[model samples]
Target chain A: MESESGDKYAADLSSIREAQMRISSYIHRTPILTAETLNSISGRKLYFKCECFQKGGAFKFRGACNAVFSLDDSQAAKGVVTHSSGNHAAALALAAQLRGIPAYIVIPRNAPNCKVENVIRYGGQIIWSEANMQSREEVATKVLQDTDAVLIHPYNDRRVISGQGSISLELLEQAPNLDTIVVPISGGGLISGVALAAKSINPSIRVFAAEPKGADDAAQSKEAGKIIKLSQTNTIADGLRASLGDLTWPVVRDLVDDIITVEDKEIVEAMRLCYEILKIAVEPSGAIGLAAILSNNFKQDPISKDCRHIGIIISGGNVDLSVLWDSLNK
Target chain B: MESESGDKYAADLSSIREAQMRISSYIHRTPILTAETLNSISGRKLYFKCECFQKGGAFKFRGACNAVFSLDDSQAAKGVVTHSSGNHAAALALAAQLRGIPAYIVIPRNAPNCKVENVIRYGGQIIWSEANMQSREEVATKVLQDTDAVLIHPYNDRRVISGQGSISLELLEQAPNLDTIVVPISGGGLISGVALAAKSINPSIRVFAAEPKGADDAAQSKEAGKIIKLSQTNTIADGLRASLGDLTWPVVRDLVDDIITVEDKEIVEAMRLCYEILKIAVEPSGAIGLAAILSNNFKQDPISKDCRHIGIIISGGNVDLSVLWDSLNK
Candidate 1:
């Protein structure tokens, strides 16, 4: 895909391979988990790539580490910058700290207190932005102009996309016979990278994107054959409210076999199931893939019909306890 | 240790080693997890042996599998029987199912609904008993007499203790530099097995026991240098309410370095931290080891002064969600 400035940023298998080597020591090789109860319920063997256990409690660490560490000494002198709701901010901050560089994070003022604390704990300087996409961009741009810091776009950068692809390299090696890989899509970085890497390894392996019904821009974009932005997004999956970016849209359109949409209720139910059966605390965004499967949203896809062995990426585990408590009780 | 009839049922290093080999294919070798956040809070390096990820969602599986599979063909034909309030019942049921043997579980009518469901899901035939220890024992005896089924005592049996001891074998290999190991004490089965195996592997290694303050029989017994029984127990850690068994008392009295008691409030706090920091669902009993450390209950122990590297057993993750919600809200 080409950016507005006519810059091409495409992720390939070779780049992903290099990214894996780059972040090997920096990131955790999280375990692939299975539960008999989950298997029986889905009627298929499921392998969960638990990035919820990943360093920084998410897969965002992989991309953030790759982007921060890939910079040259001169480019890295001013450090990195990013605007995120939660995981990416903490990830970039930690990655910058590990590289002995400063990180400037522009976060919405309404972001969870725990997430804000996580970023500060990793030594990031935070700049509060008004709670909207445009305000976040404005604040990030001002920071960039004042500090000359390089912006590390969460899901739109080439390095970040390639870095996220490293998950497939590990997943494929961990469970080689997987017929379908389900990923929770937000700005589409995870699914874009995973699809490229998985299809490169085995063309027959299908990759499906799962998104919350409240923020189904990616699903709508896939059907319309172009990128579509949502007017308003409302879901408990706070991490997946962002719309698809230009860099990730082309990859999603060409490589992704299907997109599955699940309700907010389904996301909460899957979160509870992950706690009960998988014995892990997964945020709503992380559990959405399983939520789609449990809700039978994937049953309409022909490729998913023959899927005997499925792999899922638990994207992250960072949620506000109060919010979770309220939703679970409801 | 000997039973009242003077029948010996002691577990040695060799017996534990044998149990490891016998159940190697049946049980999971759960990972040893570390978190920098956790380490910073505890003021020491902590290695968590996550038995919560074990089959049947507890370390009880290892013991149950060992006991059920150790049966000779003639004995196997009759199947197995047990009465448990939670994990052990489900563990034995699943183990028996794996061996193609019928499992008869005598559960107290007041046992948690989820635990009862787990047992039934594993194909165990349930025979309900009145909600009392004496009633459970009588019902188990009657079932054994009527069906000719062998009883697999949860923690008292030699085979079960040996099986549970295998966790120490894996922990030692995974992190050989540990100076102390902390385990939750219930009937003292887990701690007894762990203490024996860890001390045998490294005589210098200290093994500590953690119990809820409301149910501190193990601590009382250790302090008195004799087995002590509690007439009534009160704690949120339902799994640790049982007093030390006769076969386990001698082992704890001789080998356990210290027993620390934590209040119910501390356990709930630790449980919340596990959810927030480790991103894992740990039941009250499973979290008591960390709870003890967090409460500073072990500060007076002289041996703990030299302990830099510590290992803790997260025993299980089978909690009632409604109770957890209430505790967390409070």
Candidate 2:
């Protein structure tokens, strides 16, 4: 089914299917989680896309694998460059290695050691930058120019967005009757793709976007009908720190039904609940949907009571062991 | 499927099947993991039955659930009682609640607050005892006499042994081709049940037991041809501290092929590997099998290369969040 909104938000199914075929062997078709405990607690049957079990410890692998493989012979010869705190860099490196292409990553100076080591272990050439999102992007751009490597924006590229949509494709296939879906939004690539795929498959399926209140730029942008940037991102959920991208802004605005925010404390509490009750060890970002539900933040909203089976993309489950202590203390 | 051996260790098929009927609806038929990530590193094809996601946070629930449900109508009308540091107490509470029966849990004075809170949340009556296991047990015995409530020995009971075997039954059904299997042993209920069910189903499949060296009374007992009580059990894996008992010891002797010991440090390293590579949050006990594989401690054992497929039961995924820091630092 072709999306009516065109390329701005609607992903090309043919392109996504092609990407899926190319990267199918390189990535895991991660399991879908039907958490009985969650259902019994929330009174809503939950289906979680367990991408924490995906290769490279996240769903980032899918987009990275697809983007790296989608490169033509000339682009492959030129190599690839990306900026990430951790998972995307590692994913791209592994994906590039599969294609025998060189990969360069610009990592934050203070990135978690476990995540930094993962990039080096996967054979990525890492360049350190100031421990800020702006520094990462600027260094990556400089590296791309110096090395003549093509830039692969982690969440802005069409191939990456289409690749991420495959998760929802799989989810809707496994659970065709899902009436509502919520996705954790960082730069909007994941939520944009998920919303597009979900709405296309079943237009009546309500698509929600959850962002950490510390970095709820996306929610603000959705209200303003344009991109909104924050001066500082201060959430324990390091993954959902970025504001929505220019390409993702329009898509999220047009396709997504609602954009909600969860406080940092709620995120931490949700992470602890996931560990204690589900025993799944979800990182802070991965627990936002659950946080909203468990905290009753979602019940008072426009989301209707008729939304029975809720499908939530547990975006990423990559947490540094160092963070676990801080979480316990909190 | 009944073991005609008539030894206290022998668990008949009817009892095992009855446990299945009792807890099947309440617990997750936890996923079985077969991954190249583990197999490639271990020099053996690995099949892992992840009970880390089990209800009440551990495989102890299987035994506790069964023991609670196995109570006679008259006895259940009274209540159930037991003493423990954590997991067993919580499991007993959950089990008794499902049966609409009263649960009196005698936990040690200084038991982890998280465990105590979980018991109370499940509608169980809490009885505080001396912090040490010795005093805890004495108080539990007195409570049983005074109350005439059934005392479900954490691991020494016949019903518990039968219930714990359900993991092996599920593993055999999922991966019947396995030639060797490993399980972490504490009170020996899990190993006793797994060994009986696995060997009974496929007699050629060798069943091995892994334990932390600090609390290796189970291994020592098997070597000495009798149960050897530990005056002071010490291990990072608090769950595997108890020694095997009369009922569980006989089954360990008759059915289990070999018992291997691993250091606490090795367990921590294995837990890290599981978290990083397998994307699973495993407690120290859950790491026993992988620890043996990582150390090459049992690779030279009689279970040769041709065993083809090897299965390990990751008995639980319940690590107190506070323990994560200790594991990471180790």
Candidate 3:
């Protein structure tokens, strides 16, 4: 499964398996947690894949570690670069730090202070850009040219997709009887990998994408039978504001069974539930899977209505207390 | 290992092993979690026994489950009663609900709304008393006389101590190489049970009790080699305000290594660390173990200065968000 750089949709079970083996020494095999209270709340037995406990406080570390370590010595010596104002930035920084290589992080000017601090704490070289996708990409491109460093696209790279797919490899074996998996959709790297590996291992396992209604591009794309870009997006789940990438979109369009959208308020409530009942701290993006399970969209869906055992990938837990307090207060 | 009704300190390794077997079906064998960031922060390898993920969102459930299930069918039909305004009350209610028996919880009038809600959710019959020990005990005595229900002392009973000791049994097996265990001190049920079981399994393992400076009665008692009662106590860790019971005092005097007292600010900081780094929601009482590990009292201790592997029992995760928010803002 050594995919060519140009192959956007090359990630499969073999690639995911390889990624797992490669990153096994670096990443944690996070525990699966269950709450009876949550089970009764959803009327379905739910198993939470606690990626929130992963290194860098998100599942992004798995992909980042795999990509950084997969590099040959020559490329590794040249270092790596990425433009991310979220978990991926910190994760890439940490992964590079572990490999004793420099990380060039291009962050948006308005990115949360806590996230920026994480990059600095991990020894990443900061490169500021205007708070726009264009500005971020332009800055990243300049950094790449100047430093002669390898660019690791957060969710769009084939290496990253296969790396994130490792989650499914561990999860399926942990909870072998899972009838379905609910994943939070951002750039779709997480869901792309999850769907590919889970379906490959168990063809009947339903894969549903959980999206914030404010950032409903994935839902629109699903309905339109193609990738639909949004002009504007709004969501409290900051990690979920990204549009689906070309590599991830094809997988979502083909493999993802359905897309369920939940409002920001629903996502907040899910976050609170995760804290109070499950005793697990989860960022809003990580809690969207629980929100989707409790949403009417999933409850009324004819195909998945009777799925007994459900697995929710809690994607990350890297939010600021002030931000969380504001959302909970609202 | 079975003790008579009047026995208060009959808990031994056999009793703890029996309790583990009896309650195995009802309680969770909580996972051991580790964080590299935390390890570096404290300059030691730390394994966290996540009792916060227990059935009632605390380790209290283990004892409550054991106490409730150890009764004969006739005694179970008579139900159980306890006077507690903390995790123990809710734990008892939930355990009783699971066993299909009535639970009479005598809560102080000033108990937190969230804790009261938990008792109500578990269908415990609430008997409100004045916010004082005398009133709580008097009301509990009346309830026992009227309903013919057995009284389950929160920490002073043999069954509860042995039940809590199951934690050490499981922890010793999970992290077999741990040379030290740090436990928070309240009424000393948790630490008392932990010390007994941990020392019995490995005589060389050191057991340290972590206490809040505001409620340093445990430290004073250890110094005086006798139980010491505080006229008043003040700490944000509402759970650790209780003094050691007569049954627990002897064990803390003999088997416990030392008592480390930390400030409320330290506990809050540890709570923040638990949420920020470990991604675990731990109450102030639960975070005290980490606080002690980071405190100068433990770090500078001559006896335990060189201990490598340490186990921390995170006692509970039942604090209100508003309470947590206020503490963090401070």
Question: Candidate 1 iRMS, in Å?
Answer: 5.5
Ranking by TM-score: 3, 1, 2
The runs of at least 3 residues in candidate 2 whose Cα sits more than 4 Å from the true structure, single-residue gaps closed, are: A1-10, A34-43, A72-78, A131-138, A145-150, A173-177, A295-297, A323-330, B1-9, B12-15, B34-43, B131-134, B299-308, B322-330
Q: Relative to the unseen true structure, what is the C-alpha lDDT of residue B226 in candidate 3, on a scale of 0 to 100?
A: 77
Put down candidate 2 lDDT per residue, A1-330, tens digits, no spaces.
433355434355666777778788887777666755678878889887777777777788888888988889998988899998787888888888878999999998877787788788778999999988878888988998899988888898888888888888888888888998888889988877777777777778898888888888988887887788998987877778877787677778887888778887777777766766666656678889878666555887756477789987777767777555334334
TM-score for each prediction? 0.94, 0.90, 0.96
Docking class of 2: acceptable
Error of 3 at A267 (Å): 0.4
> Could you report the Cα RMSD, in angstroms, for every candidate shown?
3.3, 3.6, 3.4
Q: Residue A136 CA error for candidate 3 (Å)?
A: 0.6
**Per-residue alpha-carbon lDDT of model 1 for B1-330, expressed as tens digits?**
333346544797889999999999999899887888899888889999989999888999999999999999889889899989989999999999999998999999878787788898899999999987899999999999998989999999889999999999999999999999999999988887898788888988999899999989998888887889888888888788887888899888778888889988788878877888788888889999998877676766666678789999999988767643443334
DockQ of candidate 3, scored on C-alphas against the true complex (2 decimals)? 0.47
Find the 10 residues in a row with the least total lDDT in model 3 chain A: A1-10
Query: Model 2, DockQ value?
Result: 0.36
Candidate 3 accuracy as TM-score:
0.96
Each candidate's B-chain TM-score, in sequence, is 0.94, 0.92, 0.94
Q: Would you give me the overall lDDT of model 2? A: 0.79
Give per-residue CA lDDT, model 2, range B74-139, as digits (tens). 989888999887778888999999899888999887666766777887788998998777788889
> What overall lDDT goes with each candidate model?
0.88, 0.79, 0.89
